[model samples]
Target: MKKETQIGYRVSAICGAVALAFAGLHAMPAQAHGKNDVKHVLLISFDGLHEQDVARCIGSNACPNLALLAKSGVTYTNAHTPHLSDSFPGLAALLTGGSPKSAGLFYDVSYDRTLYAPLDSTCTGAQGWNVVFDETTGIDAKGGGPLINLDGGGAFNPDAIPYAKVGGVCTPVYPHNYIKTNTVFEVVKEHIRGSRTAWADKHAWGYDWVNGPSGKGVDDLARTEINSIDPKTGTYYLDTYTHTEVFDNIHVQALINEIDGLDSTGKTSAAVPTVFGTNFQTLSVAQKSPVADNGGYLDADFTPGPQVAAAITYLDGALGRVVSELKQRNLYSSTLIIVTAKHGQSPTDHTKLVKNGDTLTKLLEASNYLDSSGNFGQNNTTTGNLNDGSGLSGTGFVQTDDVGLIWLRDQSQKDAVVKTLKANLGCTAPGICADGPQAYILHGERLEHWFGDPANGRTPDIIVQPNPGVIYTSSKSKDEEHGGNAPDDSHLGLVVSFPGLHHGGRTDDRYVYTTQVAPTILSALDLDPDLLHSVQVEGTRTLPGLGIEHEHSQDRD
Candidate 1:
């Protein structure tokens, strides 16, 4: 039997088990809300927002709208993303109610065992791995062409794409069909009648992916590719402006259209979605800008630079517009607003910037582990010749940000690789080693503890933990990067608000993972969180102190 066919049978068996489990379960009665009660959830994420940035802007005119929301809601001061915080796994945690361990997502470009390399036809290995839908895939080579046809709503050629367990089918998978678990959107749609969900994200591919394998979770998905540099004009002018704030306004308009019973494309007669929201990118852009006084921080204080301050103010105004639109449509008091971030930017202090540093890549190259054909940092390598499997086959591939995830072609070379990395990248300085600015190596059991075991095929063989500001890019474009266990990267801003909550306007200092956002949304809608596969699989609980509780009657097991 073919691997694809075997995977299909295995999936059918799992579905049978799930159906048998559901046969013994009964749907919980919906909690009746009074007139003027919360009936909708508007979940908004400000990508790369730090908790301190919110603190610094609160009570100031720069972020009056966010301050108002915080004043009317419960703010979680110590909320965090997962330890291996990349945008893919970060948002996966938010939507799937589990970390990468349960959700089976590591990053946008990650490794897999039971998959073939779509770009490399000559690949032959027991474990095939390659980049998913990143830049190197040539999906967007025409600079937002049919391969990236979020605007035209066209699907990619499945034959030329890698396969994954999406929508219960192990066929070729698109970016929107990669997640292995059900999302809150899928749960709400399945259980709730007359419920509609809409979302806008940095890429059209992002929110669609969050809708999970079924592809029927969200009713409206708006695509605004933030990173697309136009092929003709060589600018990002189609979806962005000189500032990300101007770019985010496009999403703001889409949200308003959704509120006004219209789709993101200005289609009239669209139903107002029950759950709808979008993410903002201004703060993230500000944090990475090289221009002086444009970044998110100036000194020890959280005071943003001039451009950043303006971006915050503009974002506040955008929030005010959303609130005003809700009130105009009589939807304000009855709607739950969630203000949080997908991930946080690292090195809030500009003085911590490290540049022209490709230390880890050089070390791997010296050890003959890195493939000589492809470029290391940005994903603009030659097509067809790219390594179709993990570094263990011919040469290895290394993905580096503040942290380094190394995939080796030969597992037998693990010891030599670790020894070489420790000798070169490991830090021994006293204060730096104690966490100020240091490097740590994780392999064997330690790596498995934080990230899942590499034997599972998704986890990397080795992880290079550099100090807080040690980015492994030689490019001078951006000052800071993420995807590390550093405090600046993991710590995030989280606020939840709804009418009639007891702890409104209060601050909660308890540590919470962003994964709690998924189950919490299910609980708010009076639905069982266990409907989401990962919530049940991982035993993920709702956010603490949500005030509203549900009967744990569903037989998720």
Candidate 2:
């Protein structure tokens, strides 16, 4: 038998329900309910974390905390993020239980149909200007203008904006504007009753939107700012914090003060949430481990590897601290801590991939596809021309970290562009764009598998995938990146540990994709996993061993 299967069998037997505990590590399962039966679910996400890196942490003993958590939780051997693993969309999935296919969040800068749905020039209104949803934008473009005080201006400023200055607007959709589906957090509040929650994130776009409001509403749905100050040593250090949470050590004094205020009988007490979590940037520092951090990459230039490791380690430590505090507060065993990530980064060796040399860029450049509008592909005229002279139709191109979605003005011209891309990239028959075994093509519905929306205004006509090592970053930034189908980009780590989790430490090699994360999280929470209207037609299914049969997606190949 294969080594992996053997290991799986052994783990399955060891962690079987009602089975004898291995070395008395965990207690036998029993009924859990009510306030006493409640579980404080903590979903801690380490952004840009890679599955391989987590595995490496286990191998190298770099992340002992995570390793111990893994022992108590079920680890998915096959977990992946979307082809375009950006912070906004990734967090959207975790909170809403849907994919970009449904959410209409293809990228940070996405096209909206409602405001711009009817492409006729006569549809004039502020909504038309609110084409792309910005996380900072709290407006509902479909509703004509900003929704709440927070919409146009407030403590939480989520508003619709344009991708560029010239043509169509790229509105920024926040949790309120972005998510149309029911969220697990909402479900949790619905059934559980009397569960106070709190959350903190450094990323403007990152948050558990379903369970918490975007800004100012939840007891503590604000950002946290962290500084790696050695309070014990009275020394300054590098640390991360969100916008509203504990700042440098001195700022945290206020939090301490607030807690103290809760005790003074006559003193007014700031509301303290029963369930609260805040993110830090210490791990992000690790993922973007600079030369000062003693990892790869030179000064000013950062690699994703060390930074990812650091972020994981930082969160592990923070989680440990939180867990310890909870235990001290006598809420340890009852709390369900779910440590996860918004999404993982697509590991890129920019230095090598660029040097290997491919002609696709040059071909596109020669055809004036790169900068159609002379505004350097910013807006307006850029969206109208550039391909087969089919007027302004072929101007749609969504550039990602390692792929470019080219929408042709005319469907008939697609084959010609495909041929040109193939010839330039040197892709073989089966491959799409062949550039020294580096580039591949994804067309039609197959592309839809990776990207939820693949046709009409939702889909890109041609997806340009770079080689594994290649990362198609914009000219401005030269650091870490994501948004590709490469194994390094799509692959991520998934650890599920909760009251009803049937298995632990057992690896499931059955193929899994990023799209499944939504349904899986929903199922684990015992919520319905309906693929939202914003998502593609298909929905993710519960795994076989999880005590429920679920719909499994067919193999892409």
Candidate 3:
């Protein structure tokens, strides 16, 4: 959908929130000294989870742990991710309370017109540059495969970082610097005295952004790396359904360790995080793997396939472990457990699947639009294998999954590119394309309304939201993908659970965005939500129906 119409969703979300603002006024938890007793906030992002997934699992009693949590929580049946549901933007929405337009992050690997390449330390002829800091940005890749270091080779190599102009001087832009907004971690640490923070995720290298712009948001950020090869078995942790489960376990163990007042490794003593969590990858992998071994669903309804069912069972067990630990420490009543997702998988119906081998790029290259690399994706072989970052290497930088993100070799050629792209909406050769619905292209004012103008760096010149089930991929390794405006891609499951919740299991259908999580976390800790940089700029609202009195956040519409 064009951002023009896509933004209407946010307008509606505000209306829903306002209508339900006082619906749960009587359900406020027993306050302590005019504030909530919540000392910790555990945010679990089961990446690629849907609101229907929670409903189906809860109705069928498949996820008892989640159901129990829901029993004492407010289930926001209409929660959603931002327009571009890539993992980076998805997480940014949660941590910054800012949409991409304000946050200045579109995708994990995007392009910018103002920055220079990493190697251009001297800022020679500084101009546009491609930005890529994904798993490829690590330093310990073994023969172009799994990484060797569990910490993703420690900090990022200088050669892979981008150079941005700070105070009119070229400086290396680390992952944390890439974000234009402050994070919840920063607010918690700076405003709340003696508060420590930690986080765990699949990668250890690129996620330094979790530390926020100051570079000290998270104190004990975990160093666990899921992309690393197991030294003993030589098996890649993400190669199979079973292997992915092992990766999720590592993150879960880290969270459990944090709950026990220890570091992620469980060897060092550290303060429990004031605001900390991890993103689960098992379900995401299962949804992408082959339908045979890691099937997503058995029917168009939310019925889980064998593999998906197994993944959900494992996630619920992991959640149970976390809850058990909280109860053991008598922290359950004072901790707010938020279960949500970064984004949701697309095309739940396998019959509607569409796989056209990178049609958008094919169309662009056919018309002679080329970046430094001859094609799309990160192909900078000059930087060591681990430094394979996505950037201006390709023609105008094109990253396509369910949606197409085009940065264009020449911004002046945008009209011509749109003419060519619109001409070839039909499925081209190579893979299946079940004709189901039409796609929309966003450019000019329609695109700029949601993201900023393309004249500035970072925002893509054009965006393509393909017909519901279409994914631009020639590979046969996976069935579903995210990173788009598809229905399933943006519609997410969100829950705010605590033992003190009075109106437990209350299903709140008010539309909400995950960006609201940042302010809600601060409010739960009895801190001013205004302390968040983006919260002040975006006027981000807290989750309604949670009657916890928030400081200076009610002004948000």
List the pairs of residues colliding in candidate 3.
Answer: 130-391, 130-392, 370-395, 371-394, 371-395, 373-393
Task: Give me the candidate number with maximum lDDT.
Answer: 3
Superior candidate under TM-score, 1 versus 3: 3
lDDT tens digits, residue span 164-244, model 3 = 778988898888898888998988888777888988887777778888899889998887678788776798788876788
| Poorest 10 consecutive residues by lDDT, candidate 3 | 1-10
Cα lDDT tens digits for candidate 2, 314-377: 5566556655555566655555555556665443343443322224444554555544332322
Residue pairs with clashing backbones, model 1: 391-396, 391-408, 391-409, 392-408, 392-409, 392-410, 393-409
The C-alpha stretches of model 3 lying farther than 4 A from their native spots are 1-34, 142-146, 371-377, 383-395, 429-438, 550-557
Q: Which ten residues in a row are the worst by lDDT in model 2?
A: 1-10
Candidate 1 Cα lDDT to native: 0.66
Please give the distance, in angstroms, between residue 152's alpha carbon in candidate 2 and its true position after superposition.
12
Put down candidate 1 lDDT per residue, 25-47, tens digits, no spaces: 52211122342255678998888
The lDDT values for all models are 0.66, 0.45, 0.77
Listed in order, each prediction's TM-score against the native is 0.83, 0.66, 0.90
* TM-score between model 1 and native: 0.83
Is 1 or 2 the stronger prediction by lDDT? 1
